[model samples]
Target: MADAEGDRITLSALQDTQAIQGQTVILPTALGVAPVETTGDPRIEAGWFDNGLKRARKELGQADRSVGDERLPVLIVTRYLVDGTLHEDRAIYDLGFALDGQLLGGTRVRIRGLSLITRVPAASGQAKLDARWKQLHPKLAS
Candidate 1:
């Protein structure tokens, strides 16, 4: 959906994502009685927006002006919850700007890549999720 406040145009999308299936593997231990398992969680759902579009535009413009180019790097991190599942998503966006440092609203924002980790119900998924998230937080934040 699109909203206009004065001169700035705001765009938003909810229910715009699709769920990705997860996998779990079980391996036999050396003793042949115990099991070792590993899991890869799925992304259930996510919603993203930094509260306002005007603010984002200003920041992008400032970054472009500082670098004297429109090829500015943007990192988008989003967190959301649905039906007890927690979703964390990160994406790298390549924004296009004009020669005057104005945001090119009509230009397509290229998504270079994305990483998504989700927490879902399982025998021992929450703990593993927490530990993995903790380990990845520092790197992702930078």
Candidate 2:
């Protein structure tokens, strides 16, 4: 998390510190499941991303409860593992939290921009797609 003076604060420090009303904290999404294949079914891929958001929301909610009114402004950054590679996805700056539930307006979070540091495009065409499918989803393909 970044403080007003631009100093980074560790998670443990943030929990112990007090009255950080204006500070901004980065709440990263955890990959609870295995890495998803880039060339896999679109629905499954989308679900994986959705699950990451849910996980982040749950964490933020828990933290908010623990901190008890010292909830700093949160920036939820959702990450996904695609084809055994990690990719940082959308970063939601504005969010609201509630106990025993998800972040308010979570699903409506806008994907403002994509920052792709480097990308290795998956091989193209049917034969390559088939080969990649089998390789990536061995049990399912089998």
Clash totals for all candidate models: 0, 0
lDDT of 1 by residue, 34-138 (tens): 221212332111111221222344433322123332322223234445455766444433232222223643322221222323423445443444344234222
Report the lDDT tens digits of candidate 2 across residue range 1-142.
2232222222211223222222222322242444333222111112333355445445434221222111112232233454545544322222222223236633322122212222223232223323432332233221
- Model 2 residue 19 lDDT? 21
Query: Each prediction's TM-score against the native?
Result: 0.27, 0.25
Segments in model 2 whose C-alpha atoms lie over 4 Å from true places: 1-29, 40-45, 62-110, 117-142
Residue range with the least summed lDDT across 10 consecutive positions in model 2:
64-73
Ten residues in a row with the worst lDDT in model 1?
Answer: 25-34
**Residue 62 C-alpha lDDT in model 1:** 29
